[model samples]
Target: MTLSLYNTMTRTTSEFKPLVEGKVGIYLCGATVQGAPHIGHIRSGVNFDILRRWLTHLGYDVTFIRNVTDIDDKILHKAVHENIPWWEVAMKYEKAFAWAYETLNVQSPTYEPRATGHITQMVELMQTLIDNGSAYAPGNGDVYLDVRALKSYLTLSNQKLDDLQSTGDSEDSFKKDPRDFALWKAAKPGDPSWPTPWGAGRPGWHLECSAMAHAYLGAEFDIHGGGLDLIFPHHENEIAQSESAGWGFAKVWMHNAWVTTSGEKMSKSLGNSLLVSEIVKKVRPIELRWYLGSAHYRSMVEFSFEALEENSINFRRIEGFLIRASEILQRTPDISISEKFAAAMNDDLAVPTALADISDLVREGNSAITAGDNQSLGTIAAQVRGALYILGCDPFDSVFASGAGSNSSAMDGLVSLALAQREAARARKDFAAADAIRDQILELGIIIEDTPAGPRWTLAR
Candidate 1:
């Protein structure tokens, strides 16, 4: 099946055709760097990481851009509250986010640009908008986008001009129209400022994405992605600003749904936000990634402790099958995923369906094992591993191998020694000794299974 994605702008599922053949450019709205990443923030990372992986699997050279808003009102506020420099606050949280992403095995983007580093590009973009009359800089170093000048100002948000509320980004006195949003903010006392054509101020939240995306992905890119909550003023303003400057902007606007708690958006203010660091303590990083990426990207995930535990158990089942199959085959073999799995992924990244296919394959693999069909077991295991690889959850993938809840090398050696003793006892026909050794291994949280190949052991889930 050909790749198709839901474009937020047109409100329909459309076939994906890249601007440049065999090369796909994606711009994802990354974290704001005000605090440590929560599941809500990292959901976007995991969702887009899956998309990037799938595209790479399809032989596309993907240039993925996920930006960081290192300078923002939230960062400044946190700095003041914590009695530290704003840049320090941004850097600290930025490192935390990077750590979380790496721990979860989310692949690094081709370019991860920070908003503060691209001030010159933003200034040039503002100057272009000002020259084109779509932007005006008040003498006070504040610049506002002329929303009325754009023909389809709220097309992306699907809202009328008068029906929209003020962005509250800047004081209303500086804006010519109440609906107009700030492209740049004038400097205030104690606030971090940069020299620009307008004045020594900073970039607005919306303007930074537009400027940085243009700087890296060029005038037009294949896909622009972020959380659904950004569809309104953030993405809407980007369309108005970039199009007014005669750039094609993003071809497809993809927005992932939020991770909610108690029917409300997961947020720190609500006291329901689950930090990635906090959750990883309960479950391994690979399990956490599976839980986050299990749902369809466009569907809302109501966060719950029960659901997380359940998902973790289900992932272990898949892992258990791979371990048993590897033991039977004596090695990890190459894989060819089912066609149904590929079709599901190509259909707007229907991950839930793709995962269902994986579950079916696991069932078949287990059945083959029970039937003592080693050949069938190896084939099914390869298919399951292949599918997991596409989803970034493969057990043997180096990323997961380093951090998963697997036994350490020393533990492996110790288990092997115990198994060798058990083997000697069985060879001597001493059933009592072999049973005692098996019981001891079970007490140590290892499950030893007698198979046609040999005695196989795995850490009990």
Candidate 2:
């Protein structure tokens, strides 16, 4: 069956046809790099990573572009608050975001262009809009998209132009309409500025994405993705600025739902945000990725410590089955994603359904183990591993085994030595010593399970 995806633009699930057959170009609105990344911020990364993986699995040469807005109002505010240069703030948080993405095993994009790095592109785009009468630069060095000039200004957002509130990006006195969003902001005292035809100023949040997308992906791209919250001013403004300059912009729009907490959107202001760094310390990073990516892309995930722990346990069950099956087979099975799992993935990335299919296979593998059916175990293990590989959760994959499972090789070596000691104590009928060793291991947040084959060790939630 052909892959189908929900296009936020069409408001329907449609067959995915790339602009260039066998090649998919995807532009994802990436981090602004104002501060450390929260799980909410990384959700888009994981969701799109799965989409890119699935496309590649189907033989598409995916050129994924996830841009970083390294210069923005938030970065400047953070710099002033911390008494440092704005670039310092951007670099600090950019490194944090990079670490978070790596920890979650989100594959690196084909190109990660920084907004600050593409000021020339942004200027050229603005000049095109100005030449076409779709934008105007005030004497103040601030340029604004002429919302009234574009009949399709609100097409992506599906809202009447007048009904939208002012972008509040600039003073009302300088705007043709209060809703006209800024394409460029005039240089402010002590703010990071770039030289442009209009003046020395910085690129607006929305303009950066359009310019970066065009610079890398060209006039039109296959898929544009981000959090659903960007539907309004951010994405809407992108549509206006790009289309007004005669570019087709993104052909398909895909949005992942937010990660919320306590029935409210998760944000730094809520005081309920969970940073990726903090959560990785709680559960293995692979387990965290499973928990985040298990939900359907378009569905909101309610962030809860309890739910995260439960999901981690469920993932361990699957991982445990794979480990046991590998031992029995005497080799790691190659992933051959099952038809059912592929069908679900093809149908707009129904990850929840795909994961359920994985669970069913695990159950079948367990039953085969109980019945001593080696043939069935081998087959089931391969299917399970294939499905996990598509989801980027395969335990045997070196990516997760090396990075997510443990902190360092030295720590792993220490744990291995301790596990061996515990096993030796058990072999010698030293029940008290074994129990004490187990307790010590548990205190270190490591789980040791005794099975017929051997004692298995994993990080505990």
Best candidate, TM-score: 1
Evaluate model 2: give its lDDT.
0.89
Segments of candidate 1 deviating more than 4 angstroms:
166-170, 402-410, 416-440, 452-454
Runs of candidate 2 with Cα error greater than 4 angstroms are 166-170, 402-461
RMSD of 1: 2.4
Model 2 lDDT tens row, 139-188: 78999988888867677788887776655664468888787778999998
Highest lDDT among the candidates is held by which one? 1
In model 2, what is the error at residue 232, expressed in angstroms? Answer: 0.7
How far is 215's C-alpha from truth in model 1 (Å)?
Answer: 0.8
lDDT of model 1, residue 118: 94
